[model samples]
Target: MDPVIDVRNLVKRFRGTRRTAFAPATPDSLALDHVDLAIPEGQIYGLIGANGAGKTTLLKVISTLLLPTSGEVRVLGHDLRTEEAAVRSCLGLVTNSERSFYYRLTGWQNLRYFTGLYGMDRTTLERRARPLVDRLGLSRAMDRDYRTYSTGMQRKLAFIRAFVLETPVLLLDEPTSSLDPLSSEEIRSLIAEECQARDQTVLLSANNLLDVERLAGRVGKMSQGRLTPVESASDLDESLRVARIWLRDPRSRVEATLRTWAGGSPGRPPVRWEVQERNQRTLLRVATEEPERMLPEFLQFLLGSGLAVESVDLRSVDLEEEFLLAAREAEAEASGASP
Candidate 1:
């Protein structure tokens, strides 16, 4: 099946200004490196990245709000450049910024105005938008000027407005940035219902990994303009695990052995490790991107190295940790993107 969103070797760069004619020139900033992505139809695809990591850059390019310096991008099989209008018609985007909505207008008024952009009439707007406003706990404040609403309330309004369009594809950037925990969960539930029952396709970007882990059908980590998509949050978390090997004698050859293994060899995949002596005990924390496939061999190598077997503890990396590892891995490899 063709993907709802397709991006190939996408690159977005910002030109930098020079200080002086005699001074050295600054290179352009690379917001998006070579990125390749394919998001399937009718799925919640979660995108995560650090600040300046290119999450919003990718969304803007796919939404056709910003043009790529080079590379191909298609939305719902529509070329982003040639079919920008059609591609935009297929999307309902909610960006996370307090100023996006009008401060002078009421929440209800803002919703109506946005829906009108899609040619929605008053009756159609009132019918579809009111319930979402109420469902998001904006019923009381919908009639008040948006400037009077708190930041959280405005955020909730921004989320509700997207549904007014009822488009086939949604591009959300921090959909729950300022919401309370209960409200955040409510938005997630709404997203699930919309996607599963209506067959909508959503690409959501957020800083909170736990939210992504819970709501996304598939997960992706974006760093330094490259994206890596995973089948499941479990696939990313489980495949990349953190293991701590404790030693009664921190002075054992375990450190040397693990270091050597971590170093690149002719036939071995180097396992990342950090060694330290903590509280009079030696600690070697090893991280493997493919833990299920590598930990056993790592353990055998440990035993055979004549290291004292004090104890071994297996732990899983959280969403934040998983992103860090994935980001570091991407930067180190600096390879092209993946689906």
Candidate 2:
């Protein structure tokens, strides 16, 4: 299958002014620098990074909201620069900030407004909008004025408006940013279900790792205006040397056991351990390449040291950790430091 979105050496830059008008221009203020990415058709692709990581800038270029300083971008086989109309026809967009809609208009009216812009007929509009209202759990509020709705309700409406076209590609920028947990889950489930059932391609940008990990088929981290495809969540986290270990007991013996195990034996000293208590459990964190081997031995030592092993869990590595590590590494490498 062909790629739904293909970007090569994508670059976007913003010019910043110095305090003095005559100041010389500098080259470090680029927003995106030679970013490359490929998103497959009918797949959920996640764009993750910290603030100022160029995630939104990349999306803007793909959606035609912003022009690239240089590089090539194609959406649904249409060149982003030359075939913008074709790209727009195949795309739907949902943003964190609510777009302007007729406040006095009912939910159905708002959707009808967008459908009309898409040149959908009355019959087709009703047929398409009704199901989306129901699927998004907006049937009850379909007749209510959009202005009277809560933030969550408005967000749901915004999402439905985007889906009104039933476009082949959906571009979501922090779709769940302001939603409550229940509403966020509801929207996430809807995105997943709709994408699978309709064979639609989705490119989602989010700082929430849990949501991205749950929804995306492949994850990419953006930093310093570049995008790097992560092999897996595990690989990203491992590159940062981040892992969580839970201890059954939060006692002196447990702490001592962790120190002893991490400090190594008399011949070779182990790495130092970082310990913290979270909720009812003690967390033991250490930078080590052999967590699997070290954890087992640590557990055995705990048992030998007279500590009960209630539960030992290795917390799953996720996208957030990967993004931070990648961003920091990029910064370090740019500054000529060893990452």
Candidate 3:
């Protein structure tokens, strides 16, 4: 099947001028480098990165807001370089930036202004906009001026503006940043339902991995403007993949068992297990080269050693952990090549 968005060796660079009259101009900043991606139809893809990892630049390029320095990008089989207008027309975008909306206008007015851009008739626009406004908890505030809304409220309005268009492709940057937990859940649920019911293809970039994992079918990690497709433990790090077993083990027995396992316990691989105590319960964090392969054996060792196992189910890798691990690997590589 053809990709909804295809990018090949794409690069984006920006030039800067000197601040001082006598100073030379600053070097060009490479916002993206050799970034290749293929997002298929109807699947949600997520990009995880730090503050300056070029995630926004890559998305903007795909939206044709910024042209690529080299390489190629195609949106729904249309070349971004040659066919930019078509790409823009197909995309529904809502960035987290505060400047995306007009604060002087009411939230309802803002959305109406955006829908009018898409050529939605007044009747049709009113029909589509009402439900979204309510679902996003913007009903009462819709008629209030945008500037009167709080930061979180403004963020919700941004979501409404982007989604109200109902375009086939949705480009969301930090889609749930400023909201409360329940509101965030609502936005996430809405996106999930949109994907399932509308067959929409969503490309989202977020610092929150838990939300990303919940929403995206596939995930990518970005570091220093390089993007890597991530699946399983090795995509981040073997040690980074871990499972926690929470159980109530007596102090004397737990202490002795941990010592033996840290040493050469019988029939057990020399893996790392960290023990923490919370609310009169113990959490044993078991680290392995491969979590799926070693989980059973570790569990057996725990039970066989006369300890109760409460849960091996609470094991997972989240976005913050994965992002920092990728940054470490990138830094190590750069340091090794320096000499």
Please name the candidate that would achieve the greatest lDDT relative to the true structure.
Answer: 1
TM-score, predicted candidate 1 vs. hidden true structure: 0.80
Q: Write the per-residue lDDT of candidate 1 for residues 164-260, one digit (tens) a residue.
A: 7888898989888877788788878888776677688888898877668887888887877878776577666556678878876664465556556
Model 2, C-alpha of 37: deviation from truth (Å): 1.2
- Provide the global lDDT of candidate 3 against the true structure: 0.76
Instruction: Give every collision pair in model 3.
Output: none
Off by over 4 Å in 2: 18-28, 233-316, 327-339
Pairs that collide, model 1: none
Q: What lDDT score belongs to each candidate, Candidate 1 first?
A: 0.78, 0.76, 0.76
Q: Give Cα distance to truth, residue 205, candidate 2, Å.
A: 0.6
Off by over 4 Å in 3: 16-19, 22-25, 232-316, 330-339
TM-score of each: 0.80, 0.75, 0.74
Give the candidates in order of lDDT, highest first.
1, 3, 2
User: By TM-score, how accurate is candidate 2?
Assistant: 0.75
- Please write out the lDDT profile of model 2 over residues 1-339, one tens digit for every residue: 668888989889887755567787665478898988888878888888877788888888889999988999999899988999999898998877875588899988888788788898878878877887887777989898998888888899888777768899999998898888999999898889888887888989997776787788888878777787876554555543545556667745556565555345554335324555678777655444566666666556667777666555554445654555565556655686433
RMSD of each: 5.1, 6.6, 7.6
